[model samples]
Structures are given as structure tokens and as C-alpha cells.
Target: KEYNVAILGATGAVGTRLMQKLAESNIPVKSLKLLASKRSAGKKLKYRDDVLTVEEATPDSFDGVDLVLASAGGAVSKKLLPEAVKRGAVAVDNTSAFRMDPDVPLVVPEVNPDALENHHGIIANPNCSTIQMVVALEPIRKQFGLKQIIVSTYQAASGAGQSGLDELRDEAQEHLDGKKMDAHIFPVKGEKEHYPLAFNLLPQIDVFEKDGYTHEEWKMIHETKKIMLNDMNSGAIKVTATCVRVPVEICHGESVYFTVDDAKDASREKIQSILNDAPGVTLKDDPKKQLYPQPIDAAGKEDTYVGRVRPDQENDNAYNMWVVADNLLKGAALNTVEIGEELVKRDLI
Candidate 1:
């Protein structure tokens, strides 16, 4: 049952976390290969008690890798995943490259593990924001039949990868020192515009499409429908999103309002009750004690945190809740590894 695993982009933010998750995972890994860019090659990364050297990833890197956990950029994935697949490895891609592709299954293990059944050599991990929202929404959808979802994401700088985190840290210190704060590595990487995220928020995550919604927003909208609705006729669930980068360092939080097809089942108690026992979800709603899902609290955790559950007064059939989770864990790395774990559980590998 042991498998040889290769982690693409092994030196980046999500990739580093992927190594940790894999080290701690129960999925039988006979060996581990860390693949990064040429610039990062020869760097040593820690996995459990051993330090493994990272190699530059190329088509030849997939020699005997059984599964490839790819968290590299979309361009890297688009270039390398097919190579991994052609070499007889199941590639769990964590980029937007093949998520919407008919051949690739966009999966959040807790939300749509069954989708992995249709994988044709590649299974994509959903966006970090979409992952937490869908995990929180899945139990609700199962219990009450989701008809609509509106989400505004308070995504952390970590969602932009390591450079974004470094930008935030430098900005915070420079601001406190009363120095000029440089705004780079945010909003969009190579774009003309830049914004500091240490003490500010940018209401944009990725490039703006012609429709005015950013790519991050559009991903949330489409990925949700694709992951939730397996039936072609039932895939008309309304989903809207506004993805924002907040000052938080680790966890991405979401403010979600949704309406169910069954209006009668949308009560506050009923919704909270359902989330209480939901898989991969933690209910932390206690307004009386000022307790709710917060990024600081959700950081470093694998479970999706849900709180602020309430029936919307304006719409009887609508409800609102807050969701949070480590952008690196359930959002990216851990979820990717978890999908591989599921594959192991099902003997797919």
C-alpha cells in the first residue's frame, strides 16, 4: 500500500505545508520528493525528523512518483501535471489550471470526496476560499438543499502565497516605524497597481475579468456549482462572491448568506443544529459570550470554523453565518493531502 509521492513547488507556502501534512499523514508514503524551481533547488525542507533536498521540477521529475501533490502556480501545473500523469502518477493539482476541466475533478475531500471517483489522472483542489465555504456549505446543502449562496471572502495574505505574507510583515514594521510602506506582491503580482495589506484591505484578489468580477470571485461562483451539483439539471444553484484580501496572516474568513430550497428548514436552530454535527466543521456561535469564528483562532487548524448562524430577517428563507479556516491547511495543502489520503482509503492508488 505504500506509495512514492512527489510534492511540486515544495518550497513555497502551500508546498511547505503540504510536506508537513504528508509527513504527518497516515497515507503510506514509501518515499518523498520535493520539487521546486531551479532557484530553490538544493534547498533542504523538513518533513518529520528528516530533511529532504528539493530538486528542480521538470518533466523528468516524475520518474517513479505514484502521486504528485502540485501546489505550484497554474502555469507550472499546466506545464507539469500532464507530464506527471503521463508517467503513471495521479496528480492532485492545487491550481486553477484544470479545476473546471471536464477531465479533472475539483475536490474538497470533506465536501466532494466522491468526485475523486471520476479522476482521470488529475484531481484539482478547489480555491482556498471556495474550499472552506463549500465544506461549511456541504452539510447545510445536504440537510436543506441549497438554492443560493452569496459570499464575501476576507482572505488572508497567505492566499497569495509566500511573497504576500512577506509583504504584510514588512509593511507592518515599516508602518510602525513611520517609514514609507512599499506596496508590492498583492492584488495582482505583475500588474501596475499594488496595495499594502498590513493594516488595510483590498477588495480584490485576482485579475478583473471583463464582467468586473475578479478571477477569485468567479472561481468561488463556478467552483461551488461544479462541486455541489453532480446532476446537470440541478446545477443551476445561484452563487455570487466578492473576494477580498484582509490583514490576517493565516486563516481566511468568510461571511456567507445562503437560501435553501426548503424554506421551512431554514430556522436558526435547525441550521446551527445541522452544522453542529457536520463533518470537518466546528460550530462556535455564542454571541452572549462574544464568541465566534475568528482568523486568529482558526489559524493552524484543519477544521472549518462556522459561527454567526442566524435566520436573515429580511428574507425568511435566507440564513447567514461566518466561516474560517487556515488558508494553508483545509484550504490548500492539507486538503490536497487529504484527497490523496482518501484515494489511499479507497485503494485508488
Candidate 2:
């Protein structure tokens, strides 16, 4: 059952984490190939106790690879994943290139693993923000029918990839030293303007579409519907989002407000009871002791942390809660690796 795996973008933020997760996972990997751009080729990265050299990736890089784990940019994914597929490699991609393609399955393993059954050659990992929210809510949706979801994400800089993380750290030290802080990556890179994310928040992540909602916001809105409504005709479920880039370094936090269909049985305690036993979720809501889910606590963790489960006073069917997870882990790398495991379990590879 061992398979030869190739990790595209093996040198970037999510790419490197993908290597680590694969090393620690139960999926049988017969060999690992690290593929990056020509500039990063020849660099060495560790997988378990062995060192592997990065190779310049071309369509031929996937020749013998049974599975491809990709976190390269959308362009790289769009260019390379199909080549891998043509070569008989199944790709689990972490970019937006194929997510919305109707034929591609946008999956969060815990929320929509069954969607893996529908993939042609590529199974997409949902956006990091959408991944955590759906993981926290899908259990609730199953227990008490979900009718609506409204989310405002406090996203991490890492969501922009490694460069964003580096920019945030440099800006923080410059601000503390009273030096001019530099801005090159936050909000959107290569845009006309940039902002320092040190001790500040930008209510934007990615470019603004003509509709005035940023691309990240739109991803949350649409991806939520796609993942949640996989087996059900719940496309009527209302989903809205306001995505913001916060000053955090690792975990992404979210304030979510949702309404359930079976209001007669849904309450604060009832919601808490459901989430407490939900898979890949941790309930951290004991407000009497000043306990709640925080980014610092969720960093590097695989579970989605939830707290502040309170029924909205004005609406009998509505409730509010907080959700957090390591965007790099569950949101990207860990989830991608999990999809590979599911493929093995289902004999899809």
C-alpha cells in the first residue's frame, strides 16, 4: 500500500508543513520528492530523520509520483496539478485554482470527506477560514439543522504564506524600535499599496471584487455553501462573511453567528453539548472562569477551538460562538495530508 509522493512547493510555508505532516501521518509513503522552483532547487529539507534535496519542478517531476500534495500558488497549481494527473498521480491541492471548478471537490476532511468520492483527479482543500468554521459548525448542522451562517474572520498573516509572516515579524520589531515600519505583503501583495500588520488590523485580505467584498470574503461565503451543502440541498442556507487580516502570527480566529432550523431543541447548553463531542473540535466555553478560545492557545493545534456559545437574545433560532485553529495546520497542511489518508482508506489512489 506504500505510494511514492511528490510535494509541490516543498519549500514554502504550507509546503514545508505538508512535509512535516506527511512524515508524522499514517499514510504509507514509499518515497518523497521535494519540488520547488528553479531558484529553490538544491536546497535541502528534512523529512523525518532523512534529508531530501529539492528538485526543479516540471511536468515530468510527477512521473512516478502516486500522490501530489500541493501548496504552491494558484498559478503553479493550475500549471502543474493537471500534469501530475495526466501522469497518473492524484493531487490534493491547497490553492484556489481548482476549488470552484464544479468538477473539483473542495474538501475539509472532517466536514466533507465523502466529497472525496467525487473527485476526478484533484481534491481541493478549502480556504483556511472556511475549513475551521465548517468543522465547528458541521456537527451542529447535523444535530440541529443549519439554516444560516454569518462569520467575520480574524485571519493570521500566515494565510498570505511565508512572506507575510516574515513581514509581520520585521514590522513588529521596527515599530517597537521607533523606526519606520515597512509594508510589502499584507492585505494583498503586488497591489498598488500595502499596510503594516504590526499592532494593527486591515479589514481586507486579497483583492476587492467589483461587488466591494474582498476575494477572501467571497471565498468564505461561497466555499461554506459548497462544503456544507454537499449531500443536502441546503444551498438555501444563507452565508455572509467579513474577512480581516489580524496582527496574529499563527492561528486564525473567527466570530461566528448562526441560526439553526430546529430552534425548539437548540439552546446555548444544547449547542455546547453537541460541539463538546464533535470530532476535530474542542469546546473551550467556561465564561465563569474567564476561559475562552484564544489564538495563542490554538497555535499549532489540529483541533478547532470553540467558545462563547450563547443564544442570541433577539432571535429564538440564532446563536453566537467563537472559533480558532492554526491556519497552517488544519486550514492547510494537516487537512491536505488527511485527504491523502482518506484516499488511501477509500482505495482511490
Candidate 3:
């Protein structure tokens, strides 16, 4: 059956990618609508040979749209998502707005497909970093039972949206010419200070809170719990994250260390075996041949890449793995589209 789809924030990075994915998606589409802010309204976006004009998003945007893909910022999603739902469109939101809401389902189709079953008109796509890591770990979690997760991410500039990528490119040119690079985007643009992301690593991603953890780090910790269906009242899996903005251009890479609750001793070989055969994951852990997933290899791909699997030296139950995926695809666009596919398969849309 064909469905009418609307894309919120159609002019933005993730939003534009979502439109591209939908155009290439196997799901039958009867119509497609593109909605953005007033500044971007009337801008023409090409899909195959069809040129669609972007319109300002409003409550009426989703009038006859069966499915809405929202990649707008949190505030935009917060304001328009309910309106879309009210008009009978199921929204797959690529924003943090409703991820932690008790009623909204924070979903990664590969990790928690069942969560879609409980959607109340809106389903949240987890943070890009959180989404790829969980896709790799969920299979292990299901087979061995998770106890804790510690992740250090090497994230791409794309996670910060188009401006972040532009800033990185401009900074690189300035550095090559030995000129003073102007910082306007990296670290956090809205904050008081900005840092150069070229040939540098910034421990800060998003603004920092009084408690010391940046919002991005906190999103990983909290969103992981929510997507894993861990009860807040009960301390199930202890998750900690150190999110870093790296010099990479597209894919987000994570070094994940995790401990399982299983009492039996599970070897790294066993864990590797499960991931090698799992869906949505490609295992690339062969150190001898200098073969492992890299950001360049993973960029533009839909599957999460897993490699460097080994046991933690100190703890028998703990293991370390590296995960990578394109922040714009598996991390954002493809994930949102996958949710739409799941909804159709389950008759939720």
C-alpha cells in the first residue's frame, strides 16, 4: 500500500537525508511533502527528477500525510509533532524532544522493534551515538544480559548539523594557509565560547551543565536507558558516556566497554560470533590484516560496523568493542525511515 509522507525540517542536514532515503526506500509512497522554517520555504529540493518546494511547517502540514519524518531541532519537534499526530500522522522524530518522555517510545528498529508497538502517534529516534552503539550491543545484551556500558565516542561534525561541517571545512583551509581560524560552530555555537575542530579533539560536545556533563554525554547515558527499556526507579544497567567531537567528517566511531550480567564466563570469541551474524551489523575485527571498520568505510552506509572485540583486561565479564556508522544514515535518516517501515509492517501507521 502507498502512503503520503511529510518531512519536517526538510532543508536541514538530517531532514534532507531523510527525504533522500524516502525517495530510495522500498515503501510505496503516494505523495511526499517537504516542510521547513519560513527562511527555507519555497526552496526547491530535487528528488530523482521531481522538484518539490519546501513549505513552512504548521499544524496543517500533516493534514493528509500518513507518515511524518521529523528531523527538526527539539523545539520545532516539540511544537509541531503533536499537531501532526492530532491530524492522524504518525511521526518518527529525529530529535531529543520526546525521547525521554514516558509515553513516547525511543526506538532503534534493530535494537527495540517492539517499542514501536507502544507508540502514541510519535516515536523518537535515539541520539546518533546512542543509536549505533545500541544496535551493536543489543544482540549481546539479549544473549548475555547487560550490566553496564562505558562508551567514549569519536563523533563526526555532521552530528552538529550542516553548520558544523561547514565550520570544519573552513577551519581546515585556514589552518593549511597558516592563518588564524575563526571559530563559530564547534564545541557549541550558542555557548559563550567556540573552539576549532580541525586537527583537534574537543572533549566538549553540546553545552556543559553545572553538573559537568555535556548535554550530548547525558543524552547517551539517559537515552540508552530509555531505549533499553530500563526502569528509571530500578538501577538496571549502569551507563556512562564521554562524548567527544572529533575531526571526522561523516561517521561516528565509538569505543565501547561493557559488562554483562550473565554469571557464566562468556568469551570474546563467543560475543564476536553473535555480532558477526547479527542483522544491521557488520563485523570487521581482523587486526592481523590491519582490517577493521573505519569512519571512511562506514560513511554513507546503513549498517553499523563492529570490530576490535576483546575482553577487558581487568574484568572477566567486561569486553571492549568498536562501533561505527554514518551519523547521517544509520544514526539519523535510515533509522527514522526504518521506523516508518516497522510501523507499516506492524500496521502502526
Candidate 4:
């Protein structure tokens, strides 16, 4: 069936990539609509030989659209998604606005395509960092049973949206000229302070809460639990995270340590064998050749890359792995698109 698709926040980084993916998608499209803030209205966006003008996203934008892919910020999503759904469009949102809502299914198709079956006209894309890690680990959890997960992320600036990328570039140039760099975006922009992300690592991603964990770190923890649907009484997965922003520009890389509740005989090779064939996952480990997943290599890719698999020395049932993916693709656009595809496949749309 052909779909009339509308892309909200069409001018932003993830929104732009969402348009590109839709253009290249195998799904049949009857019409493509681009909607953004008033500041980006009337901007022309090229898609498959067609030039679509960006319209201000409003209640009327979803009048005839069948599928709405929303990559707009949270406030915009909070205000617009219900309108799209009310207008009979299924919204695949790439924001945190409704992800934790009990009614909205927080989905990563590779990990939980079944969640799409229950969508009430809206499906949420998991966080960029959370999506890739869950894609790599879900298969293992299915086969071996996950018990705990501890992750330290080396995230790219792109995860912060376009302004983050601009900040990294401008800061690097300023440093090269031996001048003090200005930071108005990285870590958190609206917060009282900002810090340079050029040739440096910031331990924070979003604002710090009274609980001491930054919002990004909390997102990783809570979102992981929600996506994995860990049964509390059954000793489901325990997740903890420390999210950091590094100098990278595209992909987010994670160092993950996890333990399974399986027999102690499970070996690293066994885990590697399981991940090697998992869906939406690419295993690229070869220590002998100094080969492993890297951000540059993972940029623009759709699959989550996993490598550096080994057993943790202190824990008998624990293992270590590294996961990486383009923060804008599998992390955002591709995952949203995947959710839309699942809706179609399951006759949920």
C-alpha cells in the first residue's frame, strides 16, 4: 500500500536524515509532506527528484497524511503528536516526549517489534544510545537471559542535534587558532553553563537532576528497562549508565558490561556466535587484526555494530562488549522508520 507521509521537524538534523531515509525507502509513497517550525517554513527540501516545501507544523498539517514521522523536539512533539493521531495518522515519534508514557510503546523493532502491535496510533523511537545497545544485547538476553548491564557511552555531538555538531566544529577551529573556544550547546544548552567538546570529554549529556544523574544517563537506565520489559519479580535486567559526550561527530559508541543468568559454562565465543547472526547487528571483532567497531566506520550505517567481546575477569557470568551506531540513523531516523515498517507489516497502521 502507498502511504502519504509527513515529516515533522523536517529541517533539523534527524528530521533531514528521516526525509532522506524515506526517499530511499522501499515503502511505496503517494505523497511526502515536510513540516517544521515557522522559522524553517517555505524551505525547499529535495527528495527523489521532487522539491517539497517545509510547512509550519500545526494541527492542520496532518489533514491527509497517513504516516507522520516526527523528529521535532519534545515540546513540539507533545503538542503535535496527538493532533496527528486524532487526524488518523500513525505517528512514529523520534523524541522522548511520549516514550515513557504507558500508553505509548517505546520500540526498537529489532528488540521488540511486538510492541508495535499495541500502538494507539503512536510509536516511540528509543534513545539513540539505548537503541543500539538494546539491539546488540537483546538476542543474547533472549538466549542466555540478561541479569545486569553497565554501560559507559562515548557519544557523538550529533546526538545533541545540529547545534551540537556546529559547537564541536567551531570549538575545534577556535582551539587551532590558539583562541578560547565558546560553548553554547554541548552537555546541555539551556542549562546555566556550557563546556567545550573539542578534544575533550564531558561526563554529562543532558542536565543533571537532583538525583545526581544527568537526564541522558537516566534515559539510558529507564529506557533500557522499558524496552527490555524486564520482569521485576523474575530478576530481570538491571541497567546502569554513565553517558558522556566526546569529540566525535556522528556515531555513538558504548562500552557495555553485562551478566547473564545462564550456566557458568557460557563462553565469550558462544556469545560472539549468538551476536554474529543477530538481526540489525554487525559483529566486527578481530583483535588479531586490530579491528573493531569505530564511529567513523559506523557513521551513515543502519545496523548496530558490536565488538570487543570478552569475559569480565571478576564475574563468572559477566561479559564485556562494545556497541556503536550512527546516532542519527539507527539511533533516530532508521529506528522510527523501522517502527513504521513494523506497523505496516503487522497491519497495525
> Which runs in model 3 stand beyond 4 Å of their true positions?
230-234
- Candidate 4's residue-wise lDDT over 1-349, tens digit each? 8889999999999999998888777667899999999998899989889888999989998998899999889999999999999999999999989988888889988887877777898888888999999999998988888889999999999988998899999999999999999988877879888889999999998888899999898888888888888321233677889999999999999999999986646789988999899999999999999889999999999989999999999878999999999999999998888787778777777
lDDT against true structure, model 3:
0.90
Candidate 4: pairs in clash = none
Q: Of the pair 2 and 4, which is ahead by lDDT?
A: 2
Off by over 4 Å in 2: 231-235, 262-264
Model 2 gets an lDDT of 0.92
Clashing pairs in 1: none
Highest TM-score against the true fold, candidate: 2
Q: Single out the weakest 10-residue window by summed lDDT for candidate 4.
A: 229-238
Model 2: which ten-residue window has the lowest total lDDT? 228-237
| Sequence-dependent TM-score of model 3 | 0.97
lDDT of 2 by residue, 210-251 (tens): 999999988888888889886223467888899999989899
Model 1's lDDT to the true fold? 0.90
lDDT of 4: 0.89
Q: How do the residues 70-94 of candidate 1 rate in per-residue lDDT, one tens digit apiece?
A: 9989999999999999999999989
TM-score of 1: 0.97
Q: Which sections of candidate 4 miss by over 4 Å?
A: 230-235
